[model samples]
Target: MEVLSLKVNGDTRCLAAAPQATLLEVLREELGLTGCKQGCDKGDCGACTVLLDGQPVLACLTLAALVQGREITTIEGLAPAHRRRCAESPCASKQDKLHPVQDAFDEAGALQCGFCQSGMILSATALLQRDDDPKRETIREALSGNLCRCTGYTQIIEAVERASDEHAGREHRPRAWEQPATEPAGEGES
Candidate 1:
């Protein structure tokens, strides 16, 4: 076992792991950060997604040894990071403690089984960090690597949009289903 120094969230963690141990194993087993799920154990599924230096990566496919001295952000770190940021602002409320993307996911009903939540949320967070107002297609492209069997991608997209809108201080828009249906044009109308 080799000792690795990893900076996760905002704290530095030192642990011993095998040279071939994946980041998922070390984060979950050694550091007790189970937010990074072990889904496919391969790169096909994004269930093990984690932010490596503000970018989403497949933790199950990343070598723990290779990630030494890099910034790793797990789902568990989202809220704390947000809280630290919120300390400077007046938006730190008890009910609003979760990261905007996380809260938006919950509010938008973007999670079902929750197996893909961590990855989805992390991906969305990364996207929003770069693009504050991403279009639907952009959002879809950004999250293409992460797959969700439950939400059908609609709510997930909406959650990302909602988070962006909120971050931009835009007025909240009703969901597609919540919007009133338009009347069909009458025969007399051209």
Candidate 2:
């Protein structure tokens, strides 16, 4: 067993893991951070995405021991990170916070089945950190690595746009899904 010291979610965590154990196993099994889903177990699926030094990486493809002393941020850490950033602001609240991206995802109905959300959210978070006002195509490219079997990318893209708008201090446009569907002109009323 290899003893690894990992700085995760603003905390230092030391644990014993197999030499070949992936970060996904260490995070989910050892650290009990299941938010980084274990899907495909290969690099193809971004379900194991996590932030390594603020860049999104696939945890399943990363060896736990190789990341010693590096900053690791999982989905569970996002809200706490936001809370810390807003600590001195009046907007800071005592209640647990959701990262803006997470909130947007929820409000935009971007989640379904929820298997791919953590990775998607993390990807979006990283993207927003780099570009607060990303265009729709940019958002799509940024999240292209993460796959969502349920939302069909539309709601997810809208969620990213909403978060971007919120960060840029712009009014959030309602997501397409959030807009009430217009009834077909009443059959006789054309």
Candidate 3:
């Protein structure tokens, strides 16, 4: 067992993991950070997305030892900050409100099955963080790595646009040729 120190969920944890252990496995097995799901163990699915030094990376393909002394942020780490604010008691709901990206997903109905929500949410948030007002092609390019089998792309794109608007306070949702349009209700029926 080798010792690996990684900053996870706002805390620094030194864990003993196997040499062949992937970062995703160590997070889930040793640190109990199950927020990084085990999907397609080969890194095809972005379910294991984690922030390495504030950048999105596929944890499933990362080595546990390689993350030593590096900052790693999981979905649990990047949860809407307001969600943790408690009243005098621990059960009180937060008042600061959800992050605009999260709220946009809800508003646009981006998540249907919830499997790819974490990856899509955080990756899109990262993109918006870099470019406050991302064009649809930019959003599409930034999110090309993630795959959502539920086919929520329309709502997901809408959610990203909404998030960019609220975060940047800029009215920049353009109907571009590269941007996909929502299918007419039931007209896509095969």
Deviating ranges (above 4 Å) for candidate 1:
81-93, 174-190
Ranking by TM-score: 1, 2, 3
| Candidate 1: tens digits of C-alpha lDDT, residues 1-190 | 9999999988999999999999999999999999999989989889999999999999999999999889999999998865756765775565546888988998899988989999999999999999998877789899999888774688888999999999999986744434445877674645
Q: Which candidate do you rate higher for TM-score, 2 or 3? A: 2
Q: Model 3: which residue pairs collide?
A: none
CA lDDT of 79 in candidate 1? 82
Could you tell me the lDDT of residue 176 within candidate 1? 46
- The model with the greater lDDT, 2 or 3, is 2
TM-score of candidate 1 relative to the true fold: 0.84
Model 3: lowest-lDDT 10 consecutive positions: 80-89
TM-score of each: 0.84, 0.83, 0.83
Stretches > 4 Å off in candidate 2: 81-96, 174-190
lDDT of 3 by residue, 19-133 (tens): 8999989989988888787788887878888888878999899998988878788877775444655333556644334566777888788988988888888788789878887
Q: Native-vs-model 2 lDDT?
A: 0.88
Clashes of each: 0, 0, 0
| Pairs clashing within candidate 2 | none
Full-model lDDT, candidate 3: 0.80
Best by TM-score, which number?
1
